[model samples]
Target: VEMMENVSKYRYANVPNLDAQVVEIPYADGRLSMVMMLPNREGLHSLQTLFRDLSYSPLASTLASLRETELLLQIPKFSIESKLNLRPTLEALGIKDIFGFDANLSGILAGKSAQIGSVLHDAKIEVNEQGTVAAAVTGISVIPLMGSTMDTFRADRPFLFAIVDQSTGSMIFAGRVVQPTWAAPSPLG
Candidate 1:
């Protein structure tokens, strides 16, 4: 057919096509992961950009408002395993709600955190050994908890993001986002 011929021609000419496979990984730990196989970096970048825009755009506000009432009506019941089991320490820390599971919260958090770091960087405030701004302080100062110092020390460093193969539990990709998009566009551009 003409369409098949055109597609073959385009493929031979190295023209990009919108053909990618998305794999969903479900964990026994109640976490869901997604892996998208894109043809090139451009496709990945565009997808990321679209996700960012959808998350922070005014349209999200309207959609969120519509869903807020429905969400509020549903009281999440904690499972026995969730209450009594002591795995995934972060979950035990009252972070039961997985906000970044979707593009909305993930993009917003990435953007906002990047923005915070940018503002701090712009201010040029000196960071202490514990990664705290020289003049800035938090409740940890008044908490007087024994493990608080350890937590603060651990939080003083940058974090990395990684993608792992669900079946094999092997790391497929690892990288760090130095600056959030809200803080600045990519330096490569």
Candidate 2:
């Protein structure tokens, strides 16, 4: 288990809708960040339901509202990685032609006959005191894509998180942790 059972300060914010205080772990570049959402209560699914109810626009706005606060942060050390074959999921989104027998990916390869046999999205991230290191590689695929002053944002329980792109306001990588040792293994592994 990646245990981050230590206390430290970070940029924090109190978000009303999520009922969680947020802490931003910025990258060296500042264009991206690791946004962790630690709910004031132990209701992780409630946080999920709120996001599902509000959609992402509200999320982008919510993130924009973060400010500095003194925070006693207690979060676990975890690495999140996932590999998923996007064929069925893509097809469900009306992207069938690409997976069809006569699919046309001509524009992709000059004359070679090639269909998008399968699209896989592999993403992983690691976060710690020295800052956060993250990367996402979408195999033939494509894809936080913030916080403030004195507050206690202890994530000793399940919570949600995302790696967002500041400029585009898109979540490049996002997931929730139900277990500390196994990243998102409780439900996602």
Candidate 3:
């Protein structure tokens, strides 16, 4: 997998083993963040349970646990895109009429007869050692002994991350990194 490695101050928290470890990488404005959760163990079941627990408890608790600390951080550099057809979901929620031929959407179509065909939603996020994809990379370079006891947070395994608005504690976007989607040249080059 592509990687984003760096040595920098990170806002981190070690949640229960059943959950995952948290790391907060704030944006330039300081009002937003890239919150990463590294599972304590490997596998799909662990990820499923971690997400389940996160849904049960708002990520705000994890966000609140952030405290600044230095570490040797290494994370995957990935871009994830999700395209979902929400027609069934909307229809299940009593929004079926919009998809009917007789459904009137002229008000939104400038007097044209346009019924909803399908509700398709698409979202993509590209992240690297920097903050978000759009954010700049600001990694620190330090020389350390190979066997030294420096703290390290390496996401060489499966992990999850979310883009959040810190002020309102809202998750703007979230995704998982299980493996490399494609083979690419390293960023260090």
Task: Evaluate model 1: give its TM-score.
Answer: 0.17
lDDT (10s digit) by residue, model 1, range 31-75:
322121222233345445433443453322222222111000001
Candidate 3 lDDT over residue span 1-189, tens digit each: 666555666788778743678888777787888888888887877777888888777788777777787766666677789999999999989998789989988778887887888889999887754446224234445535799676676777777788899889999998887764333323321
The predictions' CA RMSDs to the true structure, in order, are: 26.5, 9.7, 3.2
Candidate 2 backbone clash number: 20
Which residue segments of model 2 deviate by more than 4 Å? 5-9, 43-57, 130-150, 181-189
Model 3 ranges off by over 4 Å = 129-139, 147-149, 180-189
Considering lDDT, which of the candidate structures 2 and 3 is the better prediction for this target? 3
Best by TM-score: 3
lDDT by residue for model 2 over 95-189, one digit each (tens)? Answer: 89977778787888788776777899898876654446222111121110124333565576777788888788788888888754333211110
TM-score of 3: 0.83
Judge candidate 2 at residue 144 and give its lDDT: 3
**Reference-based lDDT, each prediction:** 0.24, 0.63, 0.73
Could you tell which candidate, 2 or 3, scores higher by TM-score?
3
Q: How many pairs of residues collide in each model?
A: 0, 20, 0
TM-score of 2: 0.73
TM-score of each: 0.17, 0.73, 0.83
